[model samples]
Target: MKLFYEDVNLQTFQAKKTDEGTDQQGRRYVVLDHTAFYPTGGGQPHDTGLLNQARVYDVEEIDGTIRHYIEGTDPLLETVHGEIDWVRRFDHMQQHAGQHILSAAFENNFNLKTVSFHLGEEVCSIDLETDHVSEEVLKMAEEQANELVLENRPIETKWVSQEELQQYPLRKEVAVAGNIRLVIIPEADYNGCGGTHPTSTGQVGTIKILHTEKQRGQTRIYFVCGKRVNRQLGEKHDVLQSLTAKMSAPQEKLADAADRLLNQNKQLEKTVEELKNQLLTFEADQYQDSLVKAVFTDRPVAELQKLAKMIVEGNEEKIVLFVNETDEKLQLICGRSADSETDMNQLIKSVLPLINGRGGGKPDFAQGGGEKLMSAESLLEAWVKQL
Candidate 1:
């Protein structure tokens, strides 16, 4: 096997085989020549390490070569020989193998291309170049893939001659003429894939298509198989337990409790609005007089504004004031009656200048806001004198 290294520090790179490879401070790293250790590529994360007879911490690829990142193995780095973690390696093989089976199944079922495939922590996903995946079709595809999984078909990988590659049907659209690697899962499917795979289909265990969604004009399928299914189930159980404690409800009654709370909140809002209307009506009656129709309130500014508009019938000589006692702001509006002699426009102009505010209107109506609640009683008395 040909190995390539650039700016290679052979001294800094260390090696060993251990489960928990490191102590507190430092660790070892193993650089391989043409490694079978799969570095993270094509959405699959890299493998963990085995150093000094323990499991190594992590495996990564730097510049196309596999590098084992060892933790506690540094002390034994000089004497210990490195080995790949085969259990984890085989698990990855099962997933990658299962992915090939499923990816081929999708391409065969829908004539859709697999754009990207990600083997994630809880689930593996295949992004297909189609916007929609109906439930019925998805179930059928899942059934077929599971059937193939049950068949326990032999999976073979080998480099084939260019002449031999022409005879077999390849799922990928691209063609390769030179040395080609093909993974053949007999009586099942074949594709141009560079990733590792299990020896047999049954090794994939049972695969479940958990969910799917449309993303970027494609259908992204979320799935789990083998040991991953158990992991996903364990995570879901833990989540439900946490929800039970956080919501302060038994597992079965949480949904009903949430629904009841939402309904009660809506009813409370309706009651609040009704009380506001009742208060507005009472406030309007207290401020009314024969020649002058007025509405004034020391409530929230928004509620005061709403009450002020409701008290006036847009007629008569009207003076409405809204005073927000908390925020210390006042709003005033004046309008003329049919027989009134007062100039409402001039009155607002004069009052606004005195209050350090700005307002204007025709002789019939004017409006403005200021911090003038202390002058409210005297201001109304003086303005009514003109009328």
Candidate 2:
């Protein structure tokens, strides 16, 4: 006898142990004559609790037998007490029952068929046969589902033979032949299910559709029910309040305030970039008649590159060598005038080994960096001596 089927509300029961065995992974498990633990099946997770004081971590059906995978090395006695985790069990019940109501509402109102379901840790989802579900259709389905919940309709379960299936208007055909369990909500839905559910629709509390997306040519609707709905609302409200305080704008004006701030930031960035370019132009003019060789302490590599480019662009008759020395590494840039016979690439390569660096460029320009073995001025002197 299945205790869960007999009474879903039965949280504790006594059962006789049938056998104990180990699986291929060396995990110990026990089988009982009767169990209230629902095994992992039909997209619902397995029930977890304690058996004879041993923690039951997993429950699965193998070869028409329920195996309770337990923690600890305790052996199972002939008769043991089992207690189900009521909080987890009741949450599953609410979610499973909510799924039925929503699935039936979709079918009754829009002919959409539920092809698959998954009850996850934070949310649950149902995959519908349709390719797309509009916002209007989603709202309509959600509204209808909550209406049934508010009505507190009775949920009936029956064990019918294969021949007795034709008497009810089943939402889908039954897959099993014998001892088929049909979960029915009068005039709303009739479907074959083995998962446990609540006795009345009102127990489901509330059903909220979070969102939907297309998956493998089907639409998967993400939703939550009961206490989870309240949890989701609380989380979202907290986030909104934080955003409003940080932006110094009310909820209604938050979006517009954000857009304006972004635009202003963009304008400021443009002005700063232009000022940097002008400053580089002024510095390049200082070394117009000779090779521009300079060393900076803790300077950005990007600034060195820009200064090298500006020096060559302003006066193509001069060679430029810029070095930046940071505490951890060395950076250098070399460039020459277009008319210069010296190959900047060859000159840079000959001196790079002194600092254990690597770089490559055209015959007129090159740049690279590596270990900070030598002083910045000494590195610049090596490049100049090669020239």
Candidate 3:
């Protein structure tokens, strides 16, 4: 017998250790005649606690038998005291119960039915039948859900036959034929579920819709309940406090401040780029009419491309080859004037393998970067020899 099924609030009980076995993963587990530990099912996580002195890390129901997986292989007493982690169990109850209320609220206000539900560690979610859910509808549903929670309606569970199921207005049909269990909230919701839930709507504390996303033609609404709402608010507060100190802006003005900072950064970048082009033009003028070749230290590949293009454009007869060197790698940017015969595209490709590099461009201009196996000047000398 599953003690949790009888009463979810039963945190501790003594049950017979019926059998012992190892799962496919080689983890040793013990089965109990009756267990208060809830197994992983119905989108709810397993309950973890202690079976006597052995710490039960996982509880799984495989093939209708509940297994209490522990840390060591030591045998447990025939009759062991089972203690469920009531904090975790109660949290799951609150969340599961809250889901029922929120789903009913959507259905009542917008006629949107819940297609699927998932209870996660941080947040819970329910997939609505509709493809789109308007903000106004969500707001109305949320308001109604909270108002319902305040009513503290009794969350009742019942085991009924197939014929008796017809008495309740179920949100969806039960899958099983014989053993049917329904979770009901007075005038709110009635649905078949195996998950544990609190006895009253007030036990759920409060419901909060975190966000939503479109999934498989349905809108998945992510939400949280009870203590999780306080946790989320605390985490967001920490982030806001940090941003306020750095930006010197209040919470309300932070968004505007961020936009102003982004715009300022863009303008500064434009100014820097214009100044760099002027300096490169002066440097290009110094190169006399000849086949230009030079190596630079700590120079970016983009700057090398700009400098190479400028030099070749000034002297239509020149073919420019520029290389930038760092300790670990080297970048090369080469180009030719319109009248020059050499194809810079094909030339760069052939030598790229020599240094294990990758890049390409038009016939007149090309750029690449590769491992620095040799000195920059020696590498440029090798490139010049290729011409």
Most accurate candidate by lDDT: 2
Candidate no. 3 TM-score: 0.89
TM-score of each: 0.58, 0.76, 0.89
Question: What's the C-alpha lDDT at position 168 in model 3?
Answer: 94
* Candidate 1 structure quality by residue, lDDT tens digits, 1-387: 211112111112233332223224465565544434556765666666454465556666556555566554234444454455566666676787788888877778767678888987667899988899889888888888888999999888767777887777877743556777788887567776666666788989978889999899999999988888778788888988897888788989988877888899999999999998898788766756545434355645566546555555444655543323224655666655454566767877765654576767776556676766456656555555545
- What would the per-residue lDDT of candidate 3 be over residues 1-387, giving only the tens digit for each residue? 977779879989998888998889999899989998888888888899999989988988898998889987677889999888888889999899999999999987788999888999999999999889988888889889999999999999999999999899999878789989999998889999988999999989999998899999999999999988889999999999999999999999999999999999999999999999999999989888578888999987777778888888847678988888888898888899888899999888877787888988889998888997788888888888999
lDDT of 2 by residue, 1-387 (tens): 679999999999999999998999999999999999999998899999999899999999999999999999967789999999988989999999999999999999999999998999899999999999999999999999999999998998999999899899999887789889999888888999999999999999999999999999999999999989999999998988999999999989989999999999999999999998899889877776658888988878888888887788746577888888888888878888777877888888888898899997888888888898988888888778886
Sorted on lDDT, highest at the top, how do the candidates line up? 2, 3, 1
- Residue 289 in model 3: shift from native, Å? 5.3
What are the lDDT figures for the candidates, one per model? Answer: 0.66, 0.91, 0.89
Error of 1 at 203 (Å): 1.3
lDDT minimum window of 10 residues, candidate 2:
309-318
Summed backbone clashes in each candidate are: 21, 0, 0
For model 3, what is the alpha-carbon lDDT of residue 291?
Answer: 87
